[model samples]
Target: MKIFVARLQGTPVFDPAGDQIGRIRDVVVGLRLGHRPNVHGFVVEVQPRRRVFLPITRVRRIEAGAVIFTGRINMRRFEQRTTETLAIGEILDLTVRFDDQPMTVYDVAMEETRPSTWEITSVALYKGRRREPRIVDWGEVSGFDTLQKDQGAAGLIAAFESLRAADMASALHDLPSKRRIEIARALNDTRLADVLEELPPDDQIGILGTLEPERAADVLEEMGPDDAADLLHDLPEEQASELLALMEPGEAAPVRRLLTYPEDSAGGVMTSEPVILPPSATVAEALAHIRQQDLTPSVAAQVYVSRPPTETPTGTYLGVSHFQRLLREPPSTQLGTVLDPSIDPIRPQFTLLQVAYYLANYNLVAAPVVDELGRLVGAVTVDDVLDHMLPEDWRERADYRDE
Candidate 1:
């Protein structure tokens, strides 16, 4: 039961039967539940396994030869032993106890012998023991200014952030296309897509070309359809077709239709992914429907409020209403009242030149696309028309044209 304040590192630990355990590498404490916490447990770096956790209660004391603890404990009992082969979820849930307080271990680093790599590891809880921290119920950790004099951890982190921001594009540019694609695939799709935005079109296309079709499709899936279509249009036709084939047919089908339209036209500029709600749908029902759908804010704008399918075709369109407009109105208000009569929609057959003129004339980000039957099929944005009217890199080529 007695505890002593000793340097955690290099402290020899022993089991209940007096068998040698391992010296302490670091002790993880659980403060997971706010204040009133305790020691999670000591993470011991040992031979054969490299790292394992022992409960604080099982330990007898800090006073003697090697940290002494209750005997008969074996490496098999420690979750760290299986870490080399365990899945990430398994390792995260494994718990360890420190000084009788409960806490979970996380982000454990492990060594892979088969593949020869360092793996980060974690633990959940100790069997039958409470957990505690090395320093219990500790307040905010300060003293960063004192540590910064020697350029400690904080300095290193700041340096890394600076380096990443300063050289992200350069680093990506220098990387082989395959390696760049590998890095991109390793990142969250949204994060990778954001980085792709910063790169030049040529580099973006190069990196995407190097990726497996499915991975490339995943990244593109995160992009706005207009942006995704634009990126696809830049790829070689065969490569573009192959990557599109890799995507879910429903998701890719609309992109393919957009491709058929001249890039400058309303149909080409619009994403086919608009959120459609039956005209009879209540404000509350529409809100719920929008929540369940994965359409983007731009797509949500052209939410085609339509009549019920069973209803005979009405000559009238329920019209598009902005989300903000919906929020301002009572939930009971019918969408028919919110219908914006002033807006003019484009026919699917409109030429790219005609769509551009409408965009330039209206100064609008989006316009509706309707079929011959007067049913809304898609919506286009100004950017889509502009991208086609003025080809990407047109500014750079302007000099040659003038010459």
Candidate 2:
């Protein structure tokens, strides 16, 4: 038999003696891969504000608006296990994107594959009265299991794996602190680092506080130096020092450099990992480096050529080479021949407004930063600039738009 989750809610359950036992409050299921979860049990409201668990094995028949069971139902209150998922409470009425179009989930249809085991097969989506409601296969949707507060931390993490870090962070922000910490614990270092960078300062500090010092240090190492520095700046000085001490010296060094500048300064917002090559490097070598790092569009759009035996914090800044210019030149052509020395580098102490103006005036996606000795230090991307320019509560507003 097939039934919709919405219909199952509020339906009455009858005992073997044909006497009313309770009304169905929720249906519990366990999450699995590829296929829908198997129905585990039913949460039955025995009295006002009181609920009990009725195992699926005890159910004899599921009739219209009612359920018939053969055994005695336990009167003990339902205690949700970590593996259980409550369909009505967690899934139904949630927003999901189907075929890239936003819609609200009105109901979920479950199919009985065997005598008692059932799995969710499809979801009913509704946009508005002007459009006909659509039913889509369960696999064709995203954002269904997001914000599932009661599911186990591992299950919640798996459900959100496809989401971008920004989207995942927004979902995590809406959950209760305990559940949020649980989910944070389940994420790997790289994924956690990305999400942490997208979160607000208070949330970043709160989540980091939950992790062990060693794990927190590893996550900080995985983040962009500027972002890692910003997070550390908000922590107690002693605690921040401890985390830095736990990190690898090489990774920690860049973050330490960023911390020396004021929070609103160019050095504070610039990433220390931009592509830096010697002026003698060939166009092919620069292209290979960009491909190997898999840098983002803004960061990969240009390369800084400096006098170097060492590239990072290069010995001396020569100039910049735009990716477009590199592509136009012969593969073996030296970078020094193509360097754009006319573009001035911003100083570390430059304010946010000055950095923005520099980038805007040059029509560049990123602008290089240099120290007093004229050695290249870092590059500030447009995204980082916008992050500082936006209102403090922008992330909260972004979450609302997703719903």
Candidate 3:
């Protein structure tokens, strides 16, 4: 794997049968799985339409000559088991060098390169303002090289642009509070959400404090209710109230509800965004409503087909459908068929301690909120609880410069 890692992508891959299987497009590893877990397989992109997986077990050898594989599997089976199909556009992004000269891999034809050796088939270059393609011989290249040429040369304009782009993508997840604040100040609301999603509570607070009340409210509205509540709880009471006042009622109301409970509890960290539909709507109507209103309601595996509200004096209390189950069954199939009656909702009164237990025990990313009468109201996301557990200013205070 390290040898291949040293070799740039678009390196040739071969089968034990001496068949020119494909070119190495991507090395798929089980990322989130346990540390040092098995290398799942390699994706060999034969052509635009013929990319396939060469599982780790199939490799007879992986030396300079051929990345010999056992046998071929059907494309459909490969797609079913793999995370994503390798696309030519992705491979085009690769930049490799042959004989120590610069070459781009974009214009390379799939069939041109020898399937058993490291080579370059094509290169993309900007001839003045227009881009030009140059095809080269793979066998002519001495060896493959990695793309790390622009580390120094401090004052170059091109170098600065390259560094700026790299820094944004490789930002430290555990940034200091002050740094977090600076990052928050610089990022727009949407990007802030991406940053905030990964930050701990202390960093979240520090970042939020740097913004004006209106801007802070905007950021909070973008955050889930539970996260917003947790942040609000950390702020000065007056500041918290001011920000709440600045937020929309729909957004503010849920955050306020979450604050009433302890941070660790389900009640404290649940989102109220899951739109509950009444049972009366048809599958087509429900689908239409979801399309029209952008409501992410609970649907059994397909699209959520929920029952309408009951005719009782209080209101209807329909069950949720986990969209996965919804798709497998027929469209006209009744909501009851897909809806799980056993979705034990967490009460708002439950403490954070109890909520954490529920999260740890359950496999759900989020759970539904309901009243004693079984009327659904909100949801509790795992991210909300995680935010609550993290330190509020750890990111900011980490900057102790060894005085």
Clashing pairs in 2: none
How many clashes does each candidate structure show, in the order listed?
A: 39, 0, 32
Report the C-alpha lDDT of model 3 over 28-121, residue by residue, as the tens digit.
4441222222345566655322445777566556766456677764343134234332222122333456556654443332221223322223
Off by over 4 Å in 2: 1-151, 398-403
TM-score of each: 0.49, 0.65, 0.49
Query: Total backbone clashes of model 3?
Result: 32
**Model 2, span 1-403: residue lDDT tens:** 5688766766789998889877776678886766677888888766423467999888998989789998788776567788777776566546689999877776677888888777888888777443355888888878855664443354346456666677677656755576678778889999999999988888899999999999999999999898999899999999999999999999999999889989899998898889999888999999998776447788998989889744458889889999999999999999999999779999989999999999989899999999999999999999999888877766655232233
lDDT of 1 by residue, 1-403 (tens): 2222223345678776777766664444333333322444565645522355665556556664477866444453234331122222122222334445544332232222222121222222222333332332122221111211111122112111222321344334433454345455455676566567545578778778766788898887776566678788889999888888888876676677778776655666676656666766677766765665444444555456776541212234467776777887799887767767877888877877787777678755577787778866677766556556665654223132333
- Indicate whether candidate 2 or candidate 3 has the larger lDDT: 2
Quote the positional error of residue 222 for candidate 2 in Å.
Answer: 1.0
Write down the TM-score for model 2.
Answer: 0.65
Regarding lDDT, does 1 or 3 come out ahead? 1
Error of 1 at 2 (Å): 40
Error of 3 at 282 (Å): 3.8
- Give the best candidate by lDDT: 2
**lDDT ranking of the models:** 2, 1, 3
